[model samples]
Target: MRRIPLFVLGVAAVAAAAVLIAPGDDEYPANVVLPSATGLIPGSKVLVNGFDAGQVDEVSIKDGRAQVTMRLTNDFAPLHAGASARIVWKAVLGERQLDVRDGPETNPVIPAGGTLDGKASDPVEMDKVLAALDPATRTHLSSLVQGLDHTVVGNETDLRQTLRQAGPAMEALGGVLRAVGSDGPAIRELVGQLNSMVTTLVNRDQQVRAIVSGLSGATEAVVQQRDQLRAALAKLPGTLGTADRMLADVPGTVDKAVPLLEDLRPATDRLPAVARTLRPVLADLRPTVAQLRPTLGALGTLLQFTPGLLDSAHGALPGTESAVTSLTPALSFLRPYTPEVVGWLSNWGSSAANYDSNGHYMRVNIPAGISSFDNNPGVMPPGMVSDPFPAPGAIAGQPWTDAFGSGVR
Candidate 1:
């Protein structure tokens, strides 16, 4: 009242106006404290019941941690004491909110002084997360998007390739679809054809059965002859062996028969010549026998005389006993001089044969064949000429038929 300053008078008026216009304390705004949550700046909205309860009003350091104070309108004050609150999405745009769920009917209410049990939410901040993204991460995301766009763009090409790879199958499917498209005619015709074929087969069934029955009968017949077949098969080996032996003999038989077969033609051609030569010889024999027949009649009387000659022919051979006895005495006497006699006889023959006609002594050289000669003259062929000149009277000493007969004997 006594001369107060103008600034002090205005501050007092503003304080009185704030107290009078403010909502009443008993009608209280909600207290939403970030008692456990730290790093929350002032003016951050506090959520309750999935809606904005209030904003962070003040922040201060209490004990070792930051304590945040918040104010809620009286509208959400009840939610603070009676319900649970959690962060929730407001919209797809850059906004967020909290959602509250009331407890079950029997659940006790949350005390105002107690903690809300909130934790730090892992939220994607549109503004902050976008701002924090570096060039590389943004580039990677861009590339991913571009790749997706490219994949979408190439979908037609990929689809065409797949279709091409599946061409035959797709064509089959198309044919099946076309077949299905025909209402009934195609199917009916196919069915009719099938029916006809089945009918034809059915009609021929009896013939087929008959053929099978005939084969069965043949098989039964073969089975009935099993023992006979076995016996025949067992004998086959012996038969084959005989055949092989015959085959083996064929070559030897052919060798012997071949020369006879070759001579057959020539022999046939000479048959008349052979007969003529034989005929003359036989005719001569017959005539000679006829001429001898008269002589033979006379020879009949001579035949009686011929008996004496025939009887003398019996004595023609020397008596074995007397001749053997004579030979012993003669051979004994001749044995000592046998070698000297032989030598003298050989020299005499040589001397007589070697002399020429004039009696002038002629020398004869031994022939080349003398090497094959031996002292044993018994081994030599009778009358084999060993001298260059004939021995004197050598041929005259023997009868014409006696090659070694000596006239002296």
Candidate 2:
């Protein structure tokens, strides 16, 4: 009796377990037919507007199409016509779900026991993408992959070193990019100018081609002369260093020159007026200068003789001084009688007017003897010693009495 009871208990436990694990036979309100079920199964969740509505009940291939029968609960009932159903991956290469997008909200729900045909849009296969590449591109891609594999195979340490070294450079590059981005308008303007320049170059394409060809030739020539170039490059550092040292003193020189520049400013300011005034003077002088060409030509000869003339003048300068000194005493002795001599000449001028057709002659008479007043001269003309004596030539061999008879009377 206890064995029978144990058997019955075992049967009851089995029945309960079977009822829990069995598939449900609940009737679905609507269904949809799909073109393909490449990644879907019967137990896949059916989604309406991205929410799980129900589960797929059966999946079978009929007439080259996948007839996916969905068992939607009452909440997902009345699946409207014109609704679209597709099996979408929940995650990349992950489990698929049935997505149903209903048509217009006003569209009538699909009738029960009716089929809704849906289009399945599958993800592109990797093979198809690979097959689409051209031969050259494929070759390049293959080479790139092989090179990467080779680089990674045994160069892990080197790769790590390279990445470490690149960190600072990448940081610096980021900083530069950030700085450039901060000046957005300036960068845009630069880009615009570059675009204009490119357009100009494009417009002059033939010229650009010629320039490129010339540059190519020049590059070849430079390559041929690389040894000389290298020698020059070797010397360039020292040259640059010397130049830098020389330039170091320039600021001091410039500071020293500041005062001079400040002083020159006033002069420079007046230069325009000076230049204006000089213009007419220079124009007028042009002809005079032209006329002076001969004179100027002789100037060189004049200059050549000037030394000799100067030497002669220097030699005679002492003699001239001596002669001038000697004349001083004679000039002093004659100084008192100068007035008498002047008076005699004034009185005798009226008396000495006689002339003949044969020749000119002076009319004059000589007194025979000295008068008492001759010791002291008077300013009057008739006084003794006032009149000048007759010239010796006029009195020669002639008696004074006869010559001066009229004057003595």
Candidate 3:
């Protein structure tokens, strides 16, 4: 103010130059070819992953396609190859925007002015949707709306109550859904098993039908005897009481049998070995048992007459005893002469055995003094010098019968 400083003026000049030369923002241009550009226009917002990062600079029709130019800030610029775009509703008021998506980082970045083929997903207009419906469909939709309006218009209170109650119902349904989801695999397996069971039942339909028919016949038979069945049923309580009383003792009996079973444990343990041993023995005995059949038959035949034989023997026993008693003395008397009788018989056989062309003849030696004709006197035959028959002790100096004592012999 007093006198403008040159240094301040120079400083202001540098600040002005810096503001004019400094870069504002880095923007990349991109083109999108869309099938339609219904709500898209210049100044429409562009979004990348739901974040505003650019705006549509222009929209024009070219070769039957809507060619849109986008100006994107550097933060979202130079989208990689394979980038895509789609026009979507920004709000319920028919406002539209372009939704962009970046491709994989591994792809090269798209250069400025590169084109992307936008997905033809124009915002849906309710009027167009209604207009596209066929007459029949529209009629059905009108009928449904009328039915709903009739159901709900006058019953607003009840509908509100139902809606309020529906909260718990929906919560319960959600819990059920969660539970079902948790056991999905198990439920699926159960369903598969049920399917298999159904298949099996189908396969065995004839047998199952036969069984059902038999059961039906049995049921009819039972029904025919309903009177008797009723009588039995009338007695059933008493019978059941008796059975209950009887069965009450069963536990006691079982308790008593436990020790017996325990006592028999050792024998039971050895039973397998016993059975193994008996197997071969029983096999070997089978032939022997077969052989004994005839003998047993003969014995059976013999036994049939055994009582008569026993009776006859019983009657003859007394007489046989008496005869044996009668023979006892004679047998005793002959017992002492047994050796002499045996010797005489042997000597007589030898003497009578002589044979010479004729029949057998006895050889005898006649003593000189033993002529049978003269019994009056002691006679000597011719050529006899001495007595051929000596006195009892003359020839042997011993008595002739000294061996025979004064005893019973």
Candidate 4:
């Protein structure tokens, strides 16, 4: 009896499991027929408008019309009536789903046994995008694809040859990568060397910074002194002005100095001759002075004797008083002669040459002919010479005259 009970329990559990694994029963929503959904796949998420509302259970064809059964969510019963259904792929190669869109609010719910007369989407049926293409474009596309297929089929040998040729290189690359992966010490040693190099550079960083800073300061100083540097530069304006003035004065100074220097040059050139001549003369003059030195010493020594000599001479000078009376007549005779001498001097030379009228130059002397421009008149043209020629606003010695009829104040 217990075996019978156990058998009954086993049969009941099997029946329950069978019901649990079964496909959709007749209790589910009735399948709707969509003539446009022939190529749609099963298990695709069905959308109402843009929202997920159900999944497609099956796709069927009958009497040249497609039928897709949509098992809708509980909240999407509004899609039961008056909704348009279309089929679309999930992704490029993904499953295809049926989507329903609600018409205007007044559109009645789709009847239970009603047919959904709708169009397939672009990818599956391509009714919309296909309509835009010309019939010739379709024929060309078909021919192009056929040509491509033929060409690819024809190049199978070449493709296999190329792939076969690439095999060795790929294997070599793989081997090299595998070798690199196995090189532990080389990689670690390289890393250590890199680290050591970095440390060395870091140790010298302060010196590099100091050099950089010094260079920066030098650059700044140079920038600040730019104008002074430019002034000191050998540019045309400042440089040539100095050159021009120097050159301009060189001729005149050379002219003035050349003759003097030339005259001195001869004296300099004859220095040996003069020295030779003066050598003996100076030799004789030295002895003559030496000989005169005794005489001068004797004269100096005779200071005491000269007073006694002078006393004797004074004693020798007897009375001139008696002669003074005779000298009166001679003195009167000299008075007349003095007046004649004064008149003779008046007719001698120009008043300038007179000692009382001590001006050295008054006129150009014919023998002294044009002594200098200093005393010569009309050396420069009249009005052409002044202390500074062409003073302010003067043009070629013409004084700047005011707009009025008078000279500038």
Candidate 5:
């Protein structure tokens, strides 16, 4: 008032305007994550309940996430949990804004500088929509719609009746659709498997045809032998009954035979090696067997004669025993004189050996004994000169004299 400087007053007015325009500390900064930050920047409006609530103070990328810092007014303080924020636009190319649909008031308030997790909604681009539909598809769609419209108009009554009848069918179809939808992956796999099987069958068509041809031939053969087959079939029941009885006893048979089988196991295991070893032996034995053939025939002949020989020997055996028994007494009587008789015979044989074909006879000579030859000739020598010698009593002269008496009278 007292001559104030005009420049200073001007600077003071600018300072008051800055202070009035700047945001106060009462505002809360909420961090929101968006899928994308396209067409968004700082100073973008944040709306709550279709009203402007705050502005985005910062927009940045941290750790690959698009982060938007929204500074909300004090009236909208403390966003609760489950509150969501979306980036929306008026039109495809319009300016983007944040729209927060918060949770109930009963939820706990979010403090200042808190975070609110959110998603970004993408606006439909007219150019992309236009690109998706080509001229031909658009033409077909128009024709299809026209046809459907005309059909619906003409079949109103029939359509109503069809819809009435199809109500339960539709309900059932809904359930089937739900089942298919729930197991869509499994159903798709099943369809793929069926398709593969069909393709394999198609590839093996020639084999399938051959199998069919074989089946037809078998059928014809069966038909030709139908009567025989029928008779066999008629007898089959009795055969089957017998077999069934045998089968029923098989358990007991097997139980009894188990020990035998176990015992035979070792032998059976050794059989293959034994058979291999026997092969060479049997080959070598073939020639021996051939040579034995004639020997076998001779043996058979000898065997026939053997019985007769044995019978004759058997009959003679008793007499032979009796003969041996009868010689026992005579043998015993001569047993004592055997040595003396043997000695005497040996000495006499030695003495008689002097007589030989050379006219040499053994002479008995005792130097001191009387000589039988005398030089005087007697009228009759008391010895017979005939072929027969006289007896000792009949002889007249003493032909021989003993020490006690004359020899002959």
Candidate 6:
């Protein structure tokens, strides 16, 4: 009876040891906080990189967040510091799972029962996507679907033909994709350059907007002048034809000019010498040219009044012409007497030239006539009358005489 009791006690100890060392003990517990626990529940499957590696042991809401406790198997236990988890759809029937991803190897491994620093991503639900759309968008989406349905309804044969033709096109597109994939580094560089360009454009967005506005205005102007442009275009063909005809004569013109060009060769050869000779002359003219600047400015100022001066001259021209016409006849009539006037002026100057100390005086002589009071009858000459007061017939019959015997009849 004592041996049986000892054996039973040993067996109990071994069973306890086995239970302590079981595979379940290798599992590590961890906690992850999520924004919501909508699809998660206790006993939900946990996947690590798409492989089942653990299970959600409990899910509780605390501080407005879903605190999920997970028991991971040994293979995925002690996840690194950067490890993350997300609740994802597992099936079409609203089934959900926790998807855990391993962190980079550079990160420190997380201890068992520790909370993961990374938060769980919220589950993406189709119903939520549908609910997010506004009424107009939903209506448009429905219309698009109906349109597609209508388009496909009666186009089976055409669709088949299109599909058949698309095979080669798809193959070509695949080849192009493969080519692009092979040149990924170059494509990446191009993409980087494009990104840099886009960034520069974004930095100068105001200038870009101004340019776009200017282009829009220019486009509008062009549109407004489209009729004029069209007319110009209509005339262009004839213009081009005329130009072509003109150009056709060019070779003959060139041929004809060849001899002239050859004839000018000697002169052309001398041009360098002429240029060299003129170099110093041009240099000498520089100061003169500089001096002329003020003069030229004055000339320009004077030139500004030229039009007004010309107008004034034009206004005076008619009066001058009329005066010249009036004076012409008088001048012509006096022309023949010019010599007599000149002689008289000369004689008068000579006559007035005689002078003495008492100044110039003219001598006068009076001879006795028939009417003189001192006249005697015995001294009377032939045909003379002695009466002081003679009859008119007697006065008429006698001729008057001066002391010089010059008779005045």
Q: TM-score: which candidate is best? A: 2
Q: Which stretches of candidate 4 lie over 4 Å from their true place?
A: 1-30, 36-39, 111-114, 122-409
* TM-score, one value per model: 0.22, 0.32, 0.31, 0.24, 0.28, 0.31
Q: For candidate 6, lDDT tens digit of each residue in 1-409? A: 7999999999999887544433357787888888876778889999876667989999988787889999988877668878888888766556788888779878987766767643545566777877999999999998999999999999999999999999999889877875786678899999999999999999999999999999999999999999999999999999999999999999999999999999999999999999999999999999999999999999999999999999999999999999989999877655544555676677677777778999986443468666476545467667864666332233346422331244221
Q: Write the per-residue lDDT of candidate 3 for residues 1-409, one digit (tens) a residue.
A: 6356877888899877544333245577889999998888899999875567999999999998999999888787668888899988766667899988889879987867789989766567877887999999999999999999988988999999999999999879877875786678899999999999999999999999999999999999999999999999999999999999999999999999999999999999999999999999999999999999999999999999999999999999999999989999887766555665676798899999888888899987766535566673665667644555433343345434432354334
Residue 222 of model 4 has an lDDT of 99
Candidate 3 stretches with Cα past 4 Å from truth are 1-29, 42-57, 61-64, 71-78, 88-93, 119-124, 132-409
Instruction: State the local distance difference test value for candidate 3.
Output: 0.83
Candidates' C-alpha lDDT: 0.62, 0.76, 0.83, 0.67, 0.79, 0.80
Position 39, candidate 5: lDDT: 73
lDDT of 4 by residue, 74-169 (tens): 465533445667776655553577767666677665433345556675464355556778999988988999999988897999989999999999
Error of 4 at 330 (Å): 97
lDDT of 1 by residue, 1-409 (tens): 5557877899999877555333455222333333344335566666653344576666666664444555556665433334544444444453544344445546554433334433335555566775789989989978999998888785988878888999999779866764574446778899999999999988999988999999999999999999999999999999999999999999999999999989897988898999999998998899888898899799789777987897786786568667878799677545544555676788768776755667746455666653465775545465555544333334445222222244122
Clashes of each: 4, 0, 0, 3, 0, 0
Ranking by lDDT: 3, 6, 5, 2, 4, 1
* Candidate 2 segments whose C-alpha is farther than 4 A from its true place: 1-31, 35-41, 44-55, 59-67, 70-83, 86-117, 120-218, 282-409
Give the Cα error of residue 19 in candidate 2, in Å.
26
Query: Lowest-lDDT window of 10 residues in candidate 5?
Result: 400-409
Ordering by TM-score: 2, 3, 6, 5, 4, 1
Considering every candidate listed, which one attains the maximal lDDT? 3
Candidate 3, residue 74: the lDDT equals 77
- TM-score for predicted model 5 compared with the true structure: 0.28
Q: Which stretches of candidate 5 lie over 4 Å from their true place?
A: 1-162, 238-288, 292-409
Clashes of 4: 3
RMSD (Å) per prediction: 37.8, 19.5, 16.3, 37.0, 22.1, 22.4
Q: Between 4 and 6, whose TM-score is larger?
A: 6
